[model samples]
Target: MTEIPLEHVHVAPDEESGGEPAPAVFVLHGRGADEEDLLPVAAELPDELHVVSLRAPDPLQGGYTWYELDLSAGGLESSQPDADDFRRSLDLIGESVERAVDAYGLDADRLGLLGFSQGAITSLSLLLEDPDRYAWVVALHGYLAESHADLDPDGIEGKPVFVGAGAGDRVIPESRTTAAVERFETLDADVASGSFPGGHGIGPQELDAVVEFVASRTA
Candidate 1:
């Protein structure tokens, strides 16, 4: 697992990490977006949580992407990230998680994931690969990748997951969202799903749900 370079931000409670470890959440932004893109959302989340926003490693049209989508497969079926590249990114993220734990004295059991759009897809990918590595996940306007279907469903059983999709999202069709939710449910994940009346973006209502979801997990 080679470590790929990643720019990121970490925010934790003002108090020193002398006592119990704090809860932490890794925030991932959408495709063509930078690490700072999700800072506002992180700010709105619970202050007690140690938030870390990561920048995707791959550069795109003046922005960044987790991996390149393989259009040849049709309908965003796969991302054409070389095995090494993908593994490096995943390793980088894991390194980031370890760094957060050491920095904030975070409880490994309370680590969570929050991602939007392409980030959301990556979050699911990470979670599926190592469910215990993450305590909970909030995926907004994202769908599961085909690779996820090959994973062992029992790995994620009983884990908490919040999947929020926009009903009017043209970017990700309802069918995709439906498939994502159904996949998690089939794996026996403790799924909490909602649909907002908007497009491929999060709104006030969805934010409220996100806040509540994190609060519940971090509480």
Candidate 2:
């Protein structure tokens, strides 16, 4: 597959990568957000993890986006993705992570994905495509994109999957976010799900859960 180039900011652990390859988490941001948007969240994660925040290939209103949503297809709550764009992004993102493993001395087996909003959607889709590639996932305020692939319970079984939702999220809808828990459960993933009392953005409680989830998996 021809991989599209991406811009990113990588934050490495304080310790050197000598005896063992460093564990890394690829951070993906929401629509209209840049790589720098989630730096704070990355900073809060375990120091042992090399945090790599990737800018979406496609530039948007002063930021970036993985794909475009066809709101006209239905509405906000039921919008459809530009299938071509989503597929291209899926391939490109996976390629980027693989390249990073070689470039930054990342442990390919210990890689994780932490994404919010559209990033969350992309993360879940990535996990479904190849569960073995990722050690764990933290998908916040996003729903599963069915167009990506068929749900494979066997492939997803026993993987650490954290599905987060904002109780008052209007952008993705609380129902949609909650639906992901069921989807992951049906796949028999070791799933941890919760809802925060907020809108489309991450709340304090959610942040704690995210940090906790990552820490547990990293150890």
Candidate 3:
């Protein structure tokens, strides 16, 4: 667990208010994006969600990256995260979720993770490392971390997981996307995956599907 509280977290309050505790969706932005990047998508989600977006630890070219990447040999590969950085990120995200739950008075049973690209990679890493920590996971245009090999998908048994991929995603090839889906399935994650007709980014149709999936989980 993270000893220090997560700093630079961006928050968007629940759209609806009652006395009851609401669900929370922690958003993770893609590489070169800031904490506020995914707030729009979060707003489009269920109004009951307390949307919280986190800034990644590593600083890059005027933006932030959860970990370093290397595209040297033909495809994407993780370069910065060794075993330690990987564990630190998982702990940081886990503790951040806990903090958000306590601070927002959010529903622990309904906590979810949403991310794009590098953010999606982190979301998957965090979820796989501590499967019981999150209720649902949504990964868009992202892959499993190359350095992360220890997986216990049984921990996430019966949990809903959505993965969105672009058919023509040049940045992350189709093979990687297939591998991600396979890995999740191997762990027995309730996987819902879709391939859109675009590249490296979420389209309207994909977003609509994600909204429906998340709504079902949050409902």
Clashes of 2: 0
Candidate 3 lDDT for residue 151: 71
All candidates' lDDT scores? 0.81, 0.88, 0.79
Q: Is candidate 1 or candidate 2 better by lDDT?
A: 2
The digit string of per-residue lDDT tens for model 1 on 1-219 reads: 323246787787654557888788899998899888988888888777888889988898888887766666556433334455556677778777776677657889888999998888778888998898899999998888776666774569989999999989887766677788898998899999999989988899999999998888877
Name the TM-score of candidate 1.
Answer: 0.89
lDDT of 2 by residue, 27-60 (tens): 9999999999988988999888998899988989
Error of 3 at 42 (Å): 1.0
> Which ten residues in a row are the worst by lDDT in model 1?
76-85
Model 1 misplaced stretches (Cα beyond 4 Å): 1-5, 14-18, 75-85, 153-155
List, residue by residue over 51-166, the lDDT tens digit for candidate 3.
88888887888888776655454445333344565567678778877877777777887789999988888888888777787899999988887666457755777678999899
Task: For model 1, state the Cα shift of residue 102 in Å.
Answer: 2.0
Each candidate structure's TM-score, on Cα atoms with residue i matched to residue i, is 0.89, 0.95, 0.88
Rank candidates, lDDT, best first: 2, 1, 3
Model 2: lDDT equals 0.88
In the predicted model 2, the residue pairs found to clash are none
Error of 3 at 200 (Å): 1.4
